[model samples]
Target: MANWNLKSFDDIYSSIAESAYKDRPNSFPKLFNKNKSTEIDYSKSKKDNEGQITKGGGTDLPNGGKVYLQPDSKKLLEDEETGYNAYYVTDTETINANTHQTYFAIRGSDGFGINLPQIKKGNFKEFNYQDWINNDAAFALTDAIVPQAKYATKGMKEKITELEEKAAPNAKMDVTAHSLGTMVSVQGLAGLSESELNHVGKAVLFDGPDTTASLKKAGYSDEKLKLLDKKLFIMSILLIQLVCSIVINHGINN
Candidate 1:
C-alpha cells in the first residue's frame, strides 16, 4: 500500500501532458510500466463488466496495483470547445479494499506545437486553436472564469459521482494540474459541493496564474474561497514572486 506523494503526482501530470503532444501508444504505456517490470498480469488487465475500465488498456503495476483510463477519456481528449484533456487514474494500494485513491490529472494548453503541425499538414480536425484563443486568452485578460474551467468543474463532478456508483465506494480523489490546467483545477474545485469536496484530497497546481479573480467572478464567496485555499499546494514561478515583491515594496513605500 504505497501512497503517492506530491512528487509522484507531479510526474503523472508531466507524463500525461507529454502524451497529449506525442503519440499515445508510444507514450501512454510508459506511464504505467515505468520500470519495465515483467510482473504485470496482462491477461487480467482487461476492462471489467462494470465498464469502469477500458478494455485492452488497463494495466497492472509492479506492486499489484491497478490503473485504468475511464471509458470516456478519448472523447475528453478530443473536446474542442474546452480543449479539456484529463485522465482518471486509480491506485488500489493507497486505500482499503473497498476504496481506492483516484487521481484526476488535467493537462494544460496544447500550445503552438500541437496546432501548428496540424495546420502545416492541412489537417483542421485535430487543431486546437480554440484552446488558445478562447480559454487561455480569456483567462489572461478577464475576470470571468474561462469556459474550460467551467467544463472541468462539470466533468470532474460527474466523473466522481459516476465512479462512486460504478467503481468503488468512498474512494478518495486528488487533483493535479499544470499551466492553464491549474486554472481549470482551482476554479473547478471551487465549484464542488461540500460533500463532494470532502471526497477530494489535496490539489497540486504548478506554474499557473492566480485564480482569485476568476473564482470571484464565478460567484464563490470569501468563505468558500478560503476553504479551497486550504486544500491547494501551489508552485509558482520566480517571475511571479519577483512581481509580488515589487508590488509589496511599492505599496509599503507609498
Candidate 2:
C-alpha cells in the first residue's frame, strides 16, 4: 500500500497541476481512472508550466467567467496543436439519456493559464501556490472570498450550478477538480440548495487543500442533511494506502 504525502504545499499543488486537462489529454484519464495508477512528483511550480484552465464568457461577465460545458459551436476550447479556438467533441459513450445508470460529470475549476489571453491582458494573478496561500488565508481570516478568488469563485459557482440543473432527479453527479479548483468546488457545493445537493454524490479532489470541513458546511440552513456521517475513503497514491476514514457525525439541531 502506497501513501501519498502532503508534506509540502508544492506536493499538493504539483499533483493538481499535473492532473489538469491541458492541450494534451495527458492528465484526465489518470484522474478519472480507478486506483492511483499515476503518481506525479511535487516538483517546484514553474512560470512556464502548462495552464489547465480555459477562459470563457469574456468581459460581458465579471472576471471573464468560466464555462464547464460550452457548446462546440462557440469554439471556446483551444486546440492542443494549433493554439486556435476549437469546439468540444462529445464522447458518444458518456451520455445516454435513456439509460438507467446516469452519471452527471460536473467539472470543477481550471487552474489559471499563462498563455491565455485573459492572463496576458492582466485580468488576475496566475493561480499558483502563492495565490492559493493568499486566497486561503484571506478566506480563513474573513470568511469571505478574497479579491483574488472572487472572480474565480463566481465563475465556478455559475458553471457548477448549470451542471446541477442538468443533473436533476435520479442522476448521480460526481465532481472532479484539481488545485484551486478543489477550493472552488467546495464553496460552490456549499452554496447549493438542499435539493441540488441531494443529486450530487462523491467528489474526487486531486492535490486539494484541506476540504474536510466542506461537507459540514454544505446544504441549506433549513435542511437536515447528514453529510458528515458518510464514509470518506482516501487512497493515498505514493504507496496506494487505501483506508476508510469515518467522518465525525453531527446533527443539525446541535
Top candidate on TM-score is 1
Candidate 2 lDDT over 123-183, as tens digits, reads 6555443333454454455454333333333333443344445433354544544444445
Over 1-254, each residue of candidate 1 has an lDDT whose tens digit, in order, gives 00111111113333333333223321232344322322222223222223233112223332243344443432442355667766555554322355566667777776454566767888777656666767788888886687777667777787667556755676677787667778888888988987788778778776788899888877789989988988888864343335545655787899
For each candidate in the order shown, give its overall lDDT on alpha carbons.
0.58, 0.34
Model 1: residue 246 alpha-carbon error in angstroms? 30
Number of clashes recorded per candidate:
0, 5
